[model samples]
Target: MTDQKFDIIVYGASSFVGQIMTRYMHEQFADESISWAIAGRSKSKLETLSKDIGLSDIEILVADASDESALKMMCERGKVVISTVGPYALYGDTLVKVCAESGTHYCDLTGEPQWIRKMQDRYESVAQKTGALIVHCCGFDSIPSDLGVHFLQQHALKKFGQTCSQINMRVAKLKGGASGGTIASIINMVKEAAGDAELRRQLKDPYSLCPPDHSFSARQRDVKMAYDEEYDSWIAPFVMAAINTRVVHRSNAMTGNNYGTDFLYEEAMVTGKDGRGKRMARATAWGMNAFMVGLAIPPVRWLLENHILPKPGEGPSEKEQLEGEYDLRFFGKTSAGDKIKCRVTGDRDPGYGSTAKMLAQAAACLAQDVPEGAVGGFWTPASILGDKLIERLREHAGLTFDLE
Candidate 1:
C-alpha cells in the first residue's frame, strides 16, 4: 500500500458521539506509534474540537456525506474509517459504497437492519473482492451481545468438547442514556419498515443476516416478555435484540458456522424474582413495543422527531456518561447438555461513553491486529475483531469479559 495520510480517519469527529470517540482515541493513543486524524463536514468545528480536546496537531479533513468523490478520497487516505454519522440509512449508503470500492476498511455504529441488509446485498461481494472489511453495529447495541457469545462459546468448546447449541444473553444491568443519533436510527427504521413489506419481513427474520444457503436446526425463541425459570426473574425483550441477534447470527454465518449450524441465541433484560417483577417486565416490554408502533405512525413520529426526542448532535451529559455502566450474562448449553456461563461488563455508560470507546477500539483493532490473509467483506465484530478487540476493550475501553 502507498504511504497514507494517516492510519485511520474518524469521519464524523465533530458530532456528539463522534467527539467522544475522537477525544478517547486522542487520550488512549497519546504517545503511541499509531497515526490518526479526525474528519467531518465542518472544518471550523473540527478545528475547534481539536483545540477543545487539546489535539490541534492532528489533521482534519472536510467532506460532506453526499460528496462521493470526497468520501472516496478520504477512504483512500485511511486504512480504516470510523463513521459515527447516522441514521445511517440516510447518510451511510454512499460512504460504504466508496469505502468498498476504494479497498478501505470501514466500521460504523449503525443498528438499522433494513439499511444494513441493503448495504450487504449491494456491497458484500465488492467489498470481498476489493479486500475491504466492512463491519457494523460495533457499539453497545451489539458488541457486548456479539462478543459475549463468542467468549462463551470458546470456553464451552474447551470445557464441553463442543460449541453451544444454544445461547441466551441477559442484560443483567445497564445504566446509560441513548444517543439522539441512535434514537433517529430507530425512528427511521420504524418509518422505513412501516411502508415496505419486504423490509418489515427482513426486520422480523431471526436469520435475516444469514446467507441464502445457510440452514439451522436449533429452535430459536420468539423473543418477548416472559418469566424465566432458570434465572428466577422476570425477563423483558431487549430493544436491541432485534439488531444484536442478527449480528450474532451473521457472525456464525461468516465464520462458516464455527459455533454450530444449529446454534440458537436470545437477548433480554432481567427484571426481578417475584410477581411485581413480572408485572414490571411485561409493562416495560409492552411499553417499548407500543412506542415502536407509535413511531411507525406518521403523527406520533412527527411529534417525537420534532418535540420529544433529542435531535442529532445532542445526547446525555458527561456526568451521566461517566456514571453509566452495564453487565451482561451469557448462558450457553452445548449439544451434549453441558452448560457454561460468561459475563461482559463495561465501566462507562452503554450508549455514549462505552459505545464511543468500543467503536474506536474496534477500528484500532482492525487497523493493528487483524490476522494476515483476512479478506474484506461485510463482517460482524465476533467474526472479524474477536479476541483482539476483546483485549482492546478490556485494556483500554473499560470493558471486561470473564467466564463463569
Candidate 2:
C-alpha cells in the first residue's frame, strides 16, 4: 500500500456531487500536501471536470463501474478511494469488491442501507482479512446524525460518567435542495422494497445493519407527528431517519456497544411551537408518506422519475449550495437522569455542498489519520473516523459540533 501512487482517488469525479467534491479538493489541499486524482468511466467528462474546476495538474484515472480489471487497477493505486457514484446497488459493487480485495480504504456518500447490507454480506470477510477500511454514509443522510450522537455521547461520558441511554436528534433548520442522483437512489431503494417483503422488513429494523451476532432487540420509536414539550416544538418524521438511526446503531454495536445495547435513538425535524407547527409537522409526515407510496406504484414512480425529480448531474446551483445550511440539535439523557445538549451545523446545503465537503474530509481522514493495521471491515463514519473526522470537519469542512 505504501507503494500506491495516489493517496486518494475521487471515483465518479464528473458526477454531480463528484464535481463539487473535486472543486473542494482543489481548493482545500495543496499539491505538495496530498497526492489525489479524479476518476470516472468517461475520459472526456473527467477532462472537462478537471478543466472546469481548474484542477489542471490533477491526475485522471478512467474506469467504468462494471469493469473489474480497470477498477482493480484503479483501486490498487490509491490508498483510499472516495466514491461519489451511487444508487450504489446498481453501480458500486465492482469498485467495492476491487477495493476490498486489494486492501484499499474506501468511503462513499451512499445512504442505501439495503445495498450497504449486501456489500457487507458479500465483502466484509474479504475486507477484514485484507484490512480494507470501508466506511459508508459519509454524506448528508447520516453523517450529522451519526457523528452528532458520537459527539454528544463522548461529552456525556466525560461529564456524567456514562453514555446517553437515549438521544433524540431534531433538525431545527435544514435548507437544501436535492439532486437527481439523490432522488434516484431513493427511488431505487423504494422500488426494491416494494418488490421484496424481506427488504421492507429490514428497512424498518433500526439495527438492520448491526452485526448478525449482536443482541440488540430494543424496539425503536418512530415519530409520525407529535408535539414535544422538551424542545417546545412539533416533530415530524425525518426522511433520512431510517438509514441514519441504523447507522448510529451499527456504530454503537461496532464500538462494543459503548452506547449500551438498550440505547434508544431517533431523528425528526422540528417545526415551531404553535398550531401552525403542528400543522406543518402533520403535513411533512403526510408528504413523506405519500412520496414513498407514490414511488412504490409503477405509474407514479415513472411519472416522478421522468417528469418530477431532477435528472442525474442536475442539482442546486452554486449560489443555493453556498447559501444553504442546517442546524441539528441533539438532546441526550443518561440513565442516571443527567442531561446533555449539543448541535451540529453546516454552512452549506446538506445534499450537495455540505455532503461533498463531509465526504472529502472522511476520505482524507481515512487516508491520513487512520493508522495502518487497524481492525478493518465495514465501518460507519462515526465508528471509524470518530474524533479525527470531527476535527477535520470543524477545521476545514465548515461544520460545527459543539455542546449547547
Candidate 3:
C-alpha cells in the first residue's frame, strides 16, 4: 500500500455540500493534528472554493470520477475519504471500489438504497479482506435514525437486560429545506425504478439493505396517513423513512441481530396534539401521496423538476441553514413491555448545515478513533462508529442525543 499522506480527504469539494464540509473541517479541525485536503474533478474550482471559504492554503487534489488511475492515486493518499458527491450511484461507485481495493476507509451521504445494496453485494467481501471500512448514509438522511436506534438499544440492554424488540421513530419537530443534489437524487431514484422491475421490488423490500438470512418479516408503515395513539397525535408518512429504516436494519444485521431477531421499526411525522392535528395529518399524508404520484407522471415530473426544483450545486443560504433545526424521537419497547424513549436533535438544518458537520465528524472518527483490527466491511455509521461518533457529533456537530 502507498504511504498515507492525509488522514482524510474531502472528495467532490466543489459541490455545494462538499464546500460546506471542507470549510467546516478547516474551521473546526484544522489544528487537531490531522492532515486533510480538498479534492474534486476541477483544480480551479477547488482552488476558488478554498479561497472563498478562507482555506486558501489547504491542500487540493484533482481527480475526476471517470479516471480510474487518478481516483486510485487519490485514494492512496488518504486513510479515510469523505465523499459528498451524489446521486452516488452515478459517480461514487468507482471511488468506493478504489477505496476498498486499496484498503482505504470511505464514507458518504448517499441515501440510495438500491445502490448501497449493489455496493455491498460487489465489495463487502473485498473490503472485509482488505480492512477497508466502507460506510454510507453518514448524513441527516440516516445518521440520526441509525445512531439513535443504536443508542436506544444500548440503553435497553443496560436497563432491561435485553434489546428493544420494537422502535417507533417520530419526527417531533423539523424545519429544513432540500438541496439540489437531494432533489436530483430522488428524481433519479424514481426514474431508475420506473423501468427496472427488480429494482422496484428491492425498493419495496424492508430487508433490502440487511444481510441475507436475517430478514425481519414485520408490518411497516408506508406513505399513508394514520393516527399514532401512543403519541396521542396524528401522523403522516415521513419522506426519509424508506432510506433510514433500511440503514437501521443493516446496523442490526452487522451487529448479528443484537437488537433482536424480531425487531420492528417504523418512522412517521407527528403532526399535532389533538383533533386539529389529526386533520392536518390526513392532509399531509394525502399531499405526500399526491406528490409521489405527480413525480411518476412524465409531464408533471418534467415541469416540477425543471421549474420548481433546485438544480445541481444550488442550496439554501447560510442564514437559512443557521435557522434550520430538527428533533427525532425513538420510542422502544422490549418483549416484556418495558419502554424507553430517546431523541436526536440538530441545531442547524437537516439537509446541509447539520449534514456537513455530521459527515465531517464521521470521517474524522473513522480516521482517528476506529480501533485496529475492527474488521472493515460494508457498514452503517452506528454499526462501526457507534458511541465514538455520537460523542464527536455532540461535541462538535451541534447534535444532542438525550433520553426523554
Candidate 4:
C-alpha cells in the first residue's frame, strides 16, 4: 500500500460533479502535498478536463466503467478512488469489485440504496479480508444527515451523559438544481422497483443498508405532510430521506447501536408554520408523489428523461453553483427528557457544488486520515470516518456543523 503511486484517484473525472471536484482538488492541493490524479473511460475527455481546469501536471488514467482490466489497473495504483460516475447501479459495480479485490479504499456520491445493498452483500467479506474501506453516500444525499446525527449525538453524550433516543432533521432551506445523473438514478430506481416487489419492500425499510443480523426493528416515522410542534412548522417528505435514513441507521448498527436500539430518526423539509405552510407541505407531498408515479410509467419516464431533465453532463453553471446553499436543522431528545438542537449548513448547492467538495474530502480522509489497521468493509461515512470527516468537511468542504 505504501508503494501506491497516488494517494487518491478521481474516477469518472470527466462527469459533471467530477469536473467541479477536480477544480476543487487543484485549488486545495496545488502544492502537490497529496499525490492524486484524474481518471475516466475517455482519454480525450480526461485530458480535456485536465486542460480545462488548467491542471496540466495532473495525470489522467483511462478506464471504462465495465472494463475490468483497466479498472483493476486503475485501482491498483491508488490508495483511494473517488467515483463521480453514477446512476451507480448501472456503471459502479466493476469499480467496487476491483477496489475490494485490490485492497483499495473507495468513496462515491451514490444515493442508490439498492445498489449499495448489493455491493455490501457481495463485497463486504472480500473487502474485510483485503482491508478495502468502501463508503457510499459521501455526498449531499446522506453526509449532512449521517454526520449531522453523529455530531448531535456526540454533543448529547457530552452534555447529558446519554445518547439521544430520537432525532429529527428538517431541511430549513435548500437551493440547488438537479443533475441528469441524479435524475437518471432516481428513474432507474423507480424503474427497478416498479417490476420487483422485493426491491420495493427493501427500499421502504429504514434499515435496508444495515447488516442483516442487526436487531433493529424500530418502525421509523414517514413524514408525508404533517404539522410539527417542535419547530412549529409543517413538514413534508425529504427527497433524500429514503437513502439518508438508511445510511444513518447503518452507522448506528455498525457501531454496535451506539445510538441505542430504540433510537429513532427521520428527515423532512420544513414548509413553515400556519396556513401557508400547510399548503406548501401538501403541495410538496403531492409533487413528490406525482414525480415518482410519473417516473414509474414508461411513457412518462421517457418524456421526463428526454425533455424535462438535465442531461448527464449538464448541471448548474459556475455562478449558480457558487450561489447555491442549504440549511439543515436537527432536533434530538434523550430518554431523560434532555433536548438539543443543531444545524448543518452548506455554502454551495447541495447536489453539485457542495457535494463535489464533500466527496473529495471524504476520499482524502479515507486516504490520509484513517488509521492503519482500521477494520474495513462496507461502511457509512459517519460510521467509519466519523469525527475525522466532520473536521474535514468543516475545514475544507464549506460545511458547518454547529450546535444551536
Candidate 5:
C-alpha cells in the first residue's frame, strides 16, 4: 500500500459542487492525521473556496483536469480522487487515464452514459492492470437505483432463497431544486456527443453499459400493474429514469450478473397530480417522450444543437441546487409470492448538493477504508462498493436506504 500524502483528494475543487464537497471533507476530517488537499486549474478559485469554507487547515494544489501531467501528479499525491468535473466526456477521460495509469482509485458523479461507455472500453484493461477502481454514478442518477436493487435483492435472497425476479423503482414523490452546474453538464454532454453518431449509439446501447456478457434487459419484467393501494396513483416517466435504470443494470452486470436473474427492472414517476391533472401530466409526458424520441433523428438533433443548451461555463446557483431533495421508492417481486418494498431518500438537492455528498463519501471509502485485494476496474456505485458505501452515506450524508 502506498503511504499516500492524502487519503482522498477532491479534484476540480473549485467548481460549485466541488466546493461543497471540499467543505464537507474539511468538516468531515478537521483533525485527522490523514492528509488531504484541493486541486483545480484556478488556484484563485480554489483559494477563494478555501476562504469561503474556512479550509485554511487543508492544503490546496493547482492542477488542471485537462492537464495530463497535473492530473497524474495529483493522483500520485492521494490514494483516491473524487472528481466533480462535468459532462466528463470532455474533462473526465483524461483524469481517468491519469489515475488508472498511476494506480489510484477514482470515483465521479457523471451521468453521461456514452462517455462512461467510452471510458470503459478504453480503460477497462488498463485500469484492471493498474488496480484502479474507476467507479461512476455515485450520485442521484444511480446511487439509490443501484443500491435500492441491491438491498431489495439481498432481502429477497434472505426471505425467499431466490433473487428478485423483477424490480420497479418509482419516485413516489419528489420536492427539490436543480443546480446550474448540473444543467450545464447535461447540456454540455448533449452538445458534445450529439454530433457523433457513434458516441450517441454508445450512450443509448443498453448492452454497451458494460461488457456484452453483462447485459440484462430491464424491460423484461411486467411494469403495467396498478400502483400499490397505499400510493395508488398513475405513474409517468421520471426525468432521470433513463439514467438511473441504466446504472442499476450496470450494477447488476458488475456483480457477476445475478441481481436480476430472469428479472425485469425499471423506474417510473409517481405523478402527485391525479384525476384531470394526472391526465394532463400523462399527456405532457407523451409530448416530452415524443420530443426525446424525435431528438434521435438527425434533423431534429441538429435543431436542438443550434437552438438549445446554454453555452459553456454557464450553469445553476449554489442556493437553488443545495435546496433540492429526491425520494425513490422501489417495488420488487418474485414468482413465489415473495414481495419487497424499499426506498432511498436523499436530503441535499439532487443535481448538486446530494450528488457532491454522495461522491465524497464514495471516494473517501475507497481512499480510507476499501479493503486491499478487492476487485478493481470500472464498476457502478453499488457493484464496486456494496454495503460499505450505503453505511457511510447514512452516517455521513444523511441519505437513507431503507428496506421494509
Candidate 6:
C-alpha cells in the first residue's frame, strides 16, 4: 500500500527453511507476474542458492537482520516481509521492529512462545499504531492446530447448535526428518532452558502466547493427555505442550472469543503398534521433560549450552529439513454424541516443508490478494485471514485440511 518497490521480500531466504521458501517461490511464481526478490546477510550464499534453486534470473538482495539501516531499507521495499530466520528470539526482534515502524506487514514460521510473547509486549503498540500485522507460528506448531480449530469452531456453530467446549488434536500418522535449522532451534531451546527459568514456565500458560486480555479461545487443561483405548489406537501426550494449544486459544481470544467462554483445547502425537509405540512416545516425553528440567540445572545447563546446541552463528543444512514431513489429526466433540474430526497432512515436513509454504503465502497473501478489513496488528493465521489462508494453502501448496 505504501508503493513499495516489491510486493513481497523474503528475509533469510538462504537459511535452511529460507531456502525452501525460496524454492516454493520459484515454483509458485515461475511464470507469474510478481515483483519479488530473495535477500539474506550473505550475497554469495544468496547467489549460490539462486543458482542451485534454478532462480538465476531472480535478483538477490543483501540485508542482515541485525543491521538496522539495511533491514529498514528492505522493509521499505516490500508491502510485506516474510521471515524464515529463527530461534527468532536471537535474530528476529530487530526486523519485527523495523516492519512495525515501516508499516510493513510481517509474518514468520515461529513456534517459540517466549519470543512471540516478547514481541507482542515490545511491539504490539507500535504495530497497532503503524498498521503492521506481525504474525508468528505460521507453521506446524500452530498453523494447522490454529486453523484446524478455527474450522472446528465454525463447523460446531453451524451444525451442532453449540460451540465445542473441548477439542483434542492428535498425530494420526506421520513420517519425517528434521532440518539442521530445526535441530539448531531445538538445541538453542535446550540452551535457553539452561539460562532462563521464567521462559520455561511462561510457555506453560495457554494465554501467555498473545498480548494481555487478548482472549484466546481455549485454555490448557491440567490433565494427563493419554491414548484413547476405545479408538484402538495409541495417542501420546501432545508434543508442543502449551505452544500449539495456547496459540489456538490466542486466536480465539483475538477473535473476541467467538467460540465461547468455556472452550477447551489439547493436542498430541499418535502412537500404535500394540500400544508399544504409545508407551515409547510417553517414555520419550518423560525423557524430554527430564532433559528440559536438566537444562535448567546449573551444572548440566552449562554443559549442554557449551557442548550441545550450536552457537548463534551456526545451524542445520538446508537440504536436511526440506526432506522432512509432519502430519496431524484433530478430533472435536460436543457434550452429546455429536462429533467432527479433521486432519492436517503436509507434503513437506512440518518444521520446514509445510512451514515454507505457510510463510511464503503468508507474506504474499498479505501483500497481494487478501480481502480487506481483516483485523490488523498481531494475529494468528486464522484470526486475521480465517478461510483466506486455508484457500491459499490448498491452491499454492500441496497442503490438506480435510474433515472426516
Q: How big is the positional error of residue 203 in model 1, measured in Å on the Cα after superposition?
A: 0.9
lDDT of each residue in 305-391, candidate 6, tens digit only:
688754543433545445555677777777675788777777766666777788887777787666676445788888887887888
The ten-residue window of minimal lDDT in model 6 covers: 312-321
Weakest 10 consecutive residues of candidate 4 by summed lDDT = 1-10
Q: Which stretches of candidate 6 lie over 4 Å from their true place?
A: 1-4, 186-200, 214-219, 222-225, 273-275, 298-324, 335-337
lDDT score, residue 64, model 6? 86
lDDT of 2 by residue, 31-105 (tens): 457789899999999998888878878888899999999998898789999999978989999999999999999
Model 2 lDDT-worst window of ten: 1-10
The residue-by-residue lDDT of candidate 4 on 82-195, one tens digit each, is: 999889999999999999999999999999999999999999999999999999999998899999999999999999999999999999999988777888899899998998
The digit string of per-residue lDDT tens for model 1 on 1-404 reads 33565778999999899999988999888986678989989999999999999995798888999999989778878999999999899999999999999889999999988888899999999999999999999999789999999999888878878899899888899898767888898888887788889888887788888776788656678667888877779899888888999999989988889988878899889999888888989898899988988898899889989998988888879999999999999988888888899999999999899999999999998899989999889989999899899998999999999988
Q: Assess every candidate by TM-score.
A: 0.97, 0.98, 0.97, 0.98, 0.88, 0.89
Error of 5 at 111 (Å): 0.1
Candidate 4 residue-pair clash tally: 0
Task: Record all residue pairs in model 1 with backbone atoms less than 3 Å apart, i.e. clashing.
Answer: none
Query: How well is each residue in 344-402 modelled by candidate 5, as lDDT tens digits?
Result: 88886776677778888888878767767876688887887888988999998978988
Better of 2 and 6 by lDDT: 2
Candidate models: Cα lDDT each: 0.89, 0.92, 0.90, 0.92, 0.75, 0.74
Stretches > 4 Å off in candidate 1: 1-3
| Model 2: lDDT of residue 44 | 98
48 Cα displacement, candidate 5 (Å): 1.4
How high is the lDDT of residue 236 in model 4?
97
User: Which is the winner by lDDT between candidate 3 and candidate 5?
Assistant: 3
The candidate scoring highest on lDDT is: 4
Better of 3 and 6 by TM-score: 3
